[model samples]
Target: MFINMASPERPVSNGKRDMEIDKYGFTGGDQYTFPGVPGELPAETVRKRETKWLVMLDNWNIWMAKRFPQLKKRCRKGIPSSLRGRAWQLLCGSRPLEAQSNQSFQDLVSSTIPETATEDIEKDLHRQFPFHEMFCQRGGAGQQDLRDVLHAYVAYNPKDGYCQGQAPVAAVLLMHMPAKDAFWCMTAILTYYISGYYSQGLEVIQVDGLIMQSLLRKVCPLAHKHMEKLNISPMLYCTEWFMCIFARTLPWPSVLRLWDMFFCEGVKVLFRCGLVLLRASLGNVASLPIIPDTYETMEKLRKLDKNDMHPEFLMHAIITLRITENDLENEHRLQMKITKKKGNSSVKLVKRVYRYAPTLQHHGIVQKTGATKHLSSVSVDSSQVAKQTQATLPQKDKLHNDAVTLTVYRPISQSSITTLSSSHTSNQQSEGPNKDFQLKNDVDQAKGTYL
Candidate 1:
């Protein structure tokens, strides 16, 4: 399963063909040369590193068999770069090449005709890793490989199409493994780790931001309060962090460590990492050179040096954080409910806008009950406004019965207003605060951690 590229003379093969696996992988016939490179790995260096890799892989298998916790603890230390590709495959449970043929991917790429997504895929190709040599040159081997992987994915799932954030993710994957393996890893990320993230509406990413906001309030109340007072939405800074899995924000080494834990643990790692970043930045953000806007804040976050984010320190801090798996599950549940309710309202609004708005604008009256009736005022209740506002809030704040004030600047018809007020009264009477905001368990859990 191991392809030795220790010596230039050693011809690497994938069993089916005689190929030399270069830094990226086998590129048909060429040696796949880079701009500035060494002749070959020193014999001693190769032996030492490869021996360590083999021994580590063997130990991983043994621990995996026993379902031991030590394996995770060891993985937290970091996977060696030499074995990172294979280790990632093992983590995601990817099948061997012999069992899963590449012919299918080849055929799909060759046979599938370019459709609507062709333009999108082409535009994002060079934008992936412009600084890196592999992807620097236009139409270079790396860029071509990136295009193939993305196009194949587009054909694989046409409905989802192509998303911008996925390019960097795929590019990082390509750095570690071949195109096919990278494609599978991308699939695993989309399907299992972060479902609905790239889908239309990006519903999951939005919910995750709200969840982060909720967690931040508990983890760093002062920082959260500062951000809230400043009117900084979680969507401002966290969108890129969540969408790209911190690929665009953190240093490469730190991102690798986070990914290592993410694959082993799950989405909870992302929450922990977000909390860590905010916690680290709390003092700096609270004082001196105060962040001006979202752009400056994000730029400052991205520029955080390795000293501020040493892998061992960050990982240790993340593990020791009060956040837990159950907390994430509860936040996810709360966010899902809120997102669904909003989604339904949006759908209804879209339907109404398209079907009735144009006609309403043109004519002042409408036919109702087989008679022409003049449009009247729309009345909204005070309590109804409170319910709507509370629903949009995070779970932590939704339970409090805070009085809300609503201002209406525009005129509304009396009939519509009465109908709205009646509906609100009925809703207020029928639904209790506990039904929508019953989160005693979450409150108790947060108290245990926050106190």
Candidate 2:
């Protein structure tokens, strides 16, 4: 029997026949249905873009070198869905890690994870993208692939382990690439693009939130004062937006467009996108009838006008804000300085127990208790680079050391998905601000800078 996973409606049955469902939630029967009207951008225009991207992608090494500025400019417009996997791999510099990491993923997925981590991953599998056909099944291929990605990630970076926001990010990567490639892309995103986001204490994530609040005040002072009046904190809405890279906040197309620029331009895109949302939602946030619940205010962001949520509109709004790359860099430095001072004031404690991967024997899973790992490698920015650093774990309750097993029958859902469009919107499809993407001839020629 086939079930319609996209909607909550009941399944229709034909007692004499077997029902089959396709990925987009359509029945496999050969019935023709009229398509919805095309958006402002026509199909031919999108196809032309897809062709242009594919040509550049086919010659990536040369294209990225000679036309780095061009690639950046086009990526701001958005990547075509068909070319997104390759485009992202190129943008994030994940290709070199693919061969090495694919073997690592294979080795880890076949082995047992810490009983706790395994339970956590299984619980989140269906919840990652329940509405999408790929993950709706109880133990379907999508869930299994999602499980493999999360499990491999924990094994690869046990220090970071599995965090709540990582699931949605992983799920989106899987939608574009093979599981192994997705793993590499996700690794680069965490370590290089947004370091400390998923780390314990989430200090960097909080710091980024402060930076957003600073930007909000400058670009939309009225909204900023209003939020301050009501005690609306950036952590309340901005954490999920940054942690998941806006996956839960914007529509799928908009998310892709933001990602395209994010990979090319780095974390600044996230800040720009966050500021745009705060500015757009100013009235909704300010006019709250009473003290607001965090989720209630967030739901307001989730339900932004379809037009405003469109990637083109959001990007236009983002570019109009007069913040510069230097402005963000200065703010980031200040936030980091404040964060380090705060960290120094607190006592650092280490937990003797490794809660994620120690005991498979007790669960009747025949893995050795003596399984050891070399320190998992991660790439950090040059300034913060160190010869060696141990994972800074937070002080936790002793109860976590106790042995316990769990059975996760139902998949736990993650955050909500936005309905914004980043695809095929001619109005929002123009190149970003000219100055932001302009390439200097000297810098372009400089070694290690172009790539």
Local distance difference test, per candidate?
Answer: 0.54, 0.56
Tens-digit per-residue lDDT, 189-282, candidate 1 = 6654665667766656656667787778767777676666556667666767776787656655667778887766556677888888887875
State how far residue 45 of model 1 sits from its true place (Å): 12
Q: What is the Cα-based TM-score of model 2?
A: 0.67
**Looking at model 1, which ten-residue stretch has the lowest summed lDDT?**
351-360
Measured by TM-score, how close is model 1 to the native structure? 0.63
Stretches of candidate 2 off by over 4 Å are 1-40, 99-103, 283-299, 336-451
lDDT of 2 by residue, 1-451 (tens): 1111122223335432224443233232221111342344567988999999989877554444235567667887878778889888766656544543436768867766688888877767766655465666789887788888888888888888888788888988988888988888888677556766787776665566666776676667776766676566566677778888877667665777888877776676788888888777764544565326555655666566666777688877765656554455555555445445455433222111000111111112221112112211111122211111112111341112322222100100011111112210100011222354332223222211000
The superposed Cα distance between candidate 1 and the true structure at residue 123, in angstroms, equals 1.1
Candidate 2 at residue 217, lDDT? 63
Clashing pairs in 2: 251-420, 253-422, 254-422, 312-428
Model 2 RMSD to the real structure?
17.2
Q: In terms of lDDT, which candidate is strongest?
A: 2
